[model samples]
Target: MKTNYLALLSLISILPLYAQQVKFEDFFTDQTMRIDYHHIGDAKSELVTIDQIYGYGIWAGSLLHLIDNFNNGAYYYKIYDEATGALIFSKGFDSYFKEYQTSDAAINGIKKAYHESAIIPYPKNKIRFALEKRGKQNELNEIFNVLIDPADLYIIKEEAKDKDVTVIKALYNGDPHTKLDVVILGDGYTSSEKAKFEKDLKRFTDLFVSSEPYKSNKNDINIYGVFKPSEESGTDEPGAGIYKNTVLNTTFYSLGSERYLLTEDNKTMRNLAAFVPYDAIYIMVNSPRYGGGGIYNFYCTFVSDNQFSDYIFLHEFGHSFAGLADEYYTSDVAYNEFYPAGLEPVEPNITRLLDKNNLKWKNLIAPGIEIPTQWEKKDYDANDYIWLKERTAMNKNIANLKRNKAPKEQIDAAQIEYNNKDKAHSDAVDKYLKSSKYWDMVGAFEGAGYSAEGLYRPMLDCLMFSKGTKPLCKVCADHAAKIIKHYTE
Candidate 1:
């Protein structure tokens, strides 16, 4: 028998492509499935239990990219076909519970339960769902596993809540499965403020597509706005003793950080977001407060009327969409130690720089550039410390004024004073950074990921690192492009 070597080579070349082409119809239907669970735990221990399974809506995720190649987030959920035991779908996501576990309350052993959900394509048959948490060294360890029967009568199949919610199609490129679909939801916008929501949505969508990577790939993206009115017109501000009857219950002062805006009402948020096909969720709060928050693959929130609203929207979306880590270390944060001492973070933007030769962004580094690149850290930190102190003091003063029922004019005056000082400080910092010899270089810069000494960022000034609307660093931008390709290609 004669064996044709050319045919053998051709077969070998196409085998991997065939394996990568996982047919959607073979394993999944066109519907979507959401598995709601209660995440209960503290700093030391955690547990997950099923709350309810929901079936509705069309799957907006890509059929070609069934597996998450990017190893991000604190937790990953995987689905396996029960009959063949084949891995079918998987995604990495961070939850509010994960952040809470790092808080002072969790460190003191005050356990809490958070409602979380994992959305996936509806399975064709029974499947095994496994939830894994990242260990200290960043290795995934399975913490919970359950076999789910899609045909079970217990699975909720009723009409989705908020089905009548108004949806604004801000941008429509093409099919959602072929484009990166982003759903924007509004909180604290009353029925009378529907026009305001529409205007805000248009402004944000335009700004988003105008940015670098998104601008270059605007034809491969879709933006939708899902608006369900709230009774009130502002979010809760616990630091100022102000509360409102918002739909999503978004609040400031989350996890002890005055500017950290987020919501614990995950169920309500998910329900409202279900009105549109979404690869990402953005909740725009109707407030003028300069506060916002983002968690990887979970959701991002920003107040709609802040002066830095545009920057916050882009920065938070970077975290929620591409899992970029915060690169500033001078500001105060609620977490005790976000990135462990010796461990490298899963985020693409920041690293511990454990090995100079094996640096994560080594390929992007220019020739003759030094690893752990040095800048004016001493001088920068000195100025930054002074600014941080003043900012904290100003925040406290404003909060007190609000609590004491001070005159609106007085509060506005204080805010205006702080805003002017803040602008001056920001300008000075930007100028100081621009004067660096390595200003345009892509080498590891010290002081990132909320640590002044150990962790490092790829560049000096990035949207992740500063307050202004600076563009993403080369490494960060490349990662964003890669993620965009994952959804659209």
Candidate 2:
């Protein structure tokens, strides 16, 4: 009876390999629609495409990852006319670019070694392919079928265990800015109080959207909360519940000293991204203290600490939203070397202003504020300038500020003490940066406690880069506007 049931189910199931006829016109209901696939690769590399996973077309913007597994390439599908199997429309779904990731690291390493003479070691690849519909009138490739690993493709489920009621309520904003789909996930503490959790999460998001910049275009943003239960303190201190398994004593002393687990990084993201059509992600963990992180064009994760979660969420969102770099140089951190001095940072905010010609925020700077403005202790807390330097001068893990550029005699002693605590320092820095290990992972400076000085932020002090209340700076606010524009009809 079991075997008979299996056979019956197989007969009723949709075949993964079957090709459905389609017409080019019917697939794209919006005549003015456009799908932009960024980051393609060389043609010499393998390219793969799979068909019809979630009624959407798929393509490989980059081919490096597919070549590694040539036996199976990425999959894609087409929606076309059934009778003639005529070509209609197709697209690439969920493209992965691991090889591109490896090459990026290699290039960065070369830059560090070469200094001023450094160059972009590897050129970005450009991979483009034209897909034909299964039963097109042209019928250029009727017999051929694109092959892919069925498991690699993600099928959108019909229902989710969790949904953001806040997003649904604000779905009717009038301005209709190109809204972003945000999926926010919480840590273990949230499950401790589910009802309040949902209400608080929704309330915060509402407050978030209601705030300036986003307020006028509220309908343009979709926010979802992924609240889960956890057993960790949600502060920025070392070893806070997320780093329990490291071989080293990776504790964040700022928050209450609690054991943290490192494994939750990617898993938390997967759980949240699983529920929405996010072009980018914003993660809000449940914690009262503050801590957060973000990467440009990547994701921003923050804690919902009552003390400063609101501002922190927006500040970190700055990095994720506009590639803004931290402007604050005072704080405790464990990194030995971050900026190379010679190379210009990719972020829009802080820069050496090397080629004032190509500065990302050149026009946004206050008229006379000098680039790398004079290092005046009086201006340390001022918003008109940005700062960057090591977190401490004590060489001990104590929290205090001192100019890193003092006389060499003093530097020598600090360096010596720093060397003595090399293991601990390295452990702390490693735990902070490079914490998340994934191909597209954009956080390496997370956990390191430093940020730019400013007041207008989403929260007081968040993990994004630093804390404080300030709406998205003009640079970030512009980026947000562009993203919103992209999705607007």
Candidate 3:
């Protein structure tokens, strides 16, 4: 009798707390489709660049929102699935203008633009988003209601700041509750362009939300954009000249080149981390320039631009966001011998094949498919191959004949042709590796596995790092899907 009485009391005491949990359906009505952009300068008019249409357009139909904020930013809370504990949604908004001027300036500009027609002076300063989670815990419950199976619940308060940048809190409610969020910032633009940028993002998110993986748990995701205006519109490197590629004409300040290169600037990385507690943070470089990078357990991202921007965006996202290893290895890179032969690589595509009897995907290989020696000298003719001959001879320290060493009279002819053709091969590799839809994993491609010396990939044309129908090998797909399952509710 005493035990029953205690159990009843426990139930009574927990009822209030349980009632406070936030549910996913509650915030649907509260979402506001707002316009966002930055004022770079008056030197350029409010014009839409072609790069924007192509690059950002690729993700045209996607959904994004803050997973943890509600009720005009009164409180904040993040949601995670009970089964996996991966964070699927979040919004951590809890800052006032006094904490930083970013949200304040952005709010002012937005308000001004909403009311006036005149062009406003571009804010020279850059605004970063930050979250305040230390105080004001009471109001959180009213705005957000935490829900597990829509039965248990809690509430929380959050605040959204309008300054030089519109900053909001975010959270993860996926299976793992793995703290992850992305801040998609745009380049500098005029007031009109800023408005357009916001519209474009809204459209993109709408499409994203309708997609397969995201549509499954649309309510649990939080996505927001911070309008940090650069000095000019389009692709550009800070304090550098504009670069024109096949798809975009913009300043390419990062490494001062249109092609992909790492930058010395760590500000974007540091500031992004400060905004939210993220297990993985991503930077969506707003340019039509095709490039991206992924720092494991840190961050991953791609730039915005045309000229194969859609393909490159997904490709880079696979690398930066999913840790997918490069599958193509024939193109020129500055590094050498990245992967040792003995150590087993974590990436699914490349393998030591050390123990073919116990190989990773041995079952998938066709019965009697020739293992090792499949790509012996007989596969490729040794002589009369100018490109292969040069690379092989160089690696072997073999000197070329007289005519090969002479400087060519055509300045841009040979090098340009080489770059263009080489890029085509790389594009082909990227396409195959990212498709993630087909292929059996038995061996390596001729030029993959980070072997600067060899150009082999696991499959004849798998997406380890190539283009077209040779979908991402099976192992790579499983690896990427594992992460998706981890973070989805």
Residue-level lDDT tens digits of model 2 in 113-169: 110000000111111123321111212232123322222335332323443322332
| Candidate 3 lDDT by residue in tens digits, 270-317 | 332333323334455565434554433334445554444444544554
Q: Which has the better lDDT: candidate 1, or candidate 3?
A: 1
lDDT of each: 0.90, 0.38, 0.38
Cα lDDT, model 1, residue 156 = 92
- Residues forming the 10-long window of minimal summed lDDT in candidate 1: 1-10
**Which of the numbered candidates is closest to the native, going by highest lDDT?**
1
RMSD of 3: 16.9
lDDT of 1 by residue, 351-391 (tens): 98888789988889978998889888999999999999999
Ranking by TM-score: 1, 2, 3
Q: Which candidate is the best by TM-score?
A: 1
**Model 3, which residues run further than 4 Å from truth?**
1-162, 167-182, 187-192, 199-222, 235-258, 261-263, 272-279, 362-368, 373-442, 452-458, 462-464, 467-471
TM-score of each: 0.95, 0.48, 0.48
